[model samples]
Structures are given as structure tokens and as C-alpha cells.
Target: MIKRALVILAPGFEEIEAVVPIDLLRRAKIEVVVAGILPGVITGSRKIRIIPDYDLGDVLEEHFDCIILPGGAEGAENLKKDIRIKELLERQILKGGWVAAICAAPGCLINFGLFLSNKFTCHPSIKAEIPLSRLEENSSVVVDGNLITGRAAGSAIEFSFEIIRQLVGEEAVKEVNRSFLSNLPMLGSIRKE
Candidate 1:
């Protein structure tokens, strides 16, 4: 059976956190549905605009193998404030599906009382907004039970790798990483000699 993943996009989402995972999951042959909280285009924190495949209302009743939430301060708040997202998350949890959140989005899980495991990681800046029982330290990504949480934008690649590893398998991760790692250039800029 084909694995289906749902990515929820709200206005001011973190583009890297959403796009990287969506791309990697597709490469792993997982069917991904990008759902926007609003109609038409959803804009990112960096002002990058994306047109979602469907509105959130369209997929509320659909069953997904995994549901992903990407973090930006405003985006996360928008998601957290919506009772519908909370209801959707509760349903996903009850069905034993994986719940993944990155950056500020993890805080949404905490606010909704959806943290099945104590260990989690989120954008450190969000630490002040919510009270955390325990946080997994020095990790770009934390996977406790069916819950997966990632740090900031810098960790998006590793975050997606871990997600693919979960939804697919280690072998698919190896195959994707082999190609991705080989193509990534060194961090520093070139010198015009």
C-alpha cells in the first residue's frame, strides 16, 4: 500500500521545513498532500508563496499515514489557534499515525496536550512561550514513539531524512541521502581569484 502523508500549511509557514520533507517523502514514493489552512495561496515567513493542493477543510475526514506541521512563529500560532487542527491531531494520534512537527510547530503539540512522549525538540525561541516537561537536548531531530520533532530551519534536511526513514525505511533513506549528499556543495562561498 502506498503511504500517504499530509502537510498542513498555514500562512507564515517555514518553507524549508515544509518543502524539504515534502520533496524527500515524494522521492521515497510516499503520496503527499499539501493542505492549506486558507484558500488559494499560503505565504511563508520569508514571503515565499505556495499554492496548496487542497484546503484543510477538504481533507479533514481523510486518513493519512502521517501528518506534518512545519514551524514559523506566526504559522504555528495560526495552527494552534485553530480547533480544527487540534481535532485533526487528536484523530491522528488515536489512529496510531505518526505526528511530525518542526521548529515552533512542536509547541503546538504541547499546547494541545498531544505530547505522547516527554522528549521533544523545537525552535529554542519557543521555549519561552510554552512550559515543557522535558526536552531532548543537542539533537536536530527527536523521535519518541510516533511523535517526531525537529529543530530550526538549519535542521530541515536532517529532519526530512529522519521522517523518510520513518515512513519508508532506512534503505530508502540511504538511497536518497546518497544522491543528496553527493550534490551538496561546501558551506563557504567561492573566492573570486
Candidate 2:
């Protein structure tokens, strides 16, 4: 039943972090809708332009089963600063929908007051920015309830795999990993609360 997911992209989004998960998820038969937070095309941190599949204003909140956020200083900041985006994230969680963010995107959760006691990780630069009591270093992807997060862009594969497992199952994740020739652990670290 993992049919559709929403990947919200903002300007200055990390190209790899934003695209890889979308591509991987789609390859795994998960429908991913790229939602542009801004009006028109969005430019990544590397200045790559991506036309979103839909604008945030155009989509209904109840249709998606999950929402994934990518990381880049400006991108994450933009998502965090918008009241509407924060409200959507909060609603997604309140409705028991899956939510995942990688690298600096987890800071958005902290800013929106959603990172409380959620074991997570972000880029090293923003490590100090998150409330220390909630995050753990050296972890690949930290899935605390519905909130799943990974450290840096380097962990995007693992992050995406974790999402695949949540959406599909361990067998599906393993098959995808094998198809991609990935030798990394089939599952990411499961941090004990």
C-alpha cells in the first residue's frame, strides 16, 4: 500500500540528497511527488535547476503517506522558516505518516519543535544547533517513531534504504540494495530509546 510519497524541495536543496532518494524510491515502485516550496523552478546548492512535479500550494495534505526533506543550509532554512511548511510537517506526524530528513534537514524538525527526544542526526556543522539531548552521532539513519533522519549527505543511500524498509519491508530493501550492488548493512542502526 506504499503508493505515494511527497518529497518537498526548496531552493538550495542538496542535489544528491534530494534526487537520490526520489530516484531510489521510484525505482522501488514507490510513487514520489516532488513538491516545490517556491513558485517556480528551484535551484540546488550546486546551482542545478529542478522543476518540481507540483507546487506545495497545489497539493492536498492528506494524499501522501510520507514526506521526505532534503538538506542544504538554505533549503533546510527555507523549509524551517515557513509557517505553512512547519504546520504541514506537524500535521503529517500527528496523522501517523512517515517523515524523514537527512543532513541539515533534521534541524528543521528541531526548529519546528518536532525533534524533542527524537534520536536523530544531521551534518556536523549543524550538530551544535540541535538540542543535544535528542540526537546521537555515529549513527547512519535514526528512526524514532515516525521521524527518521540520517547524518550527512554521505548517508543518503542508507537513509533511502531505511525509508524503503519502512514503506516496503526488509526483503524489499535487501532486493533494492542488491540491485544497486550496495554492500552496506541491509538495515540502518536501530537506536534504543
Q: What do the candidate models score in CA lDDT, each in turn?
A: 0.85, 0.84
Work out the TM-score per prediction.
0.91, 0.94
The top-ranked prediction according to TM-score is: 2
Where is model 1 more than 4 Å wrong at Cα? 129-133, 182-193
Q: Distance (Å) between predicted and true CA of 55, model 1?
A: 0.1
**lDDT of candidate 2 over 29-133, digit per residue (tens):** 898999998878999999999999988988855577779999999999998877877888878877888999998899898888885777878898899878777
Q: Number of clashing pairs, model 2? A: 0
Candidate 2 segments whose C-alpha is farther than 4 A from its true place? none
Cα RMSD for candidates in order? 7.1, 1.3
Model 2 misses residue 37 by how many Å? 0.7
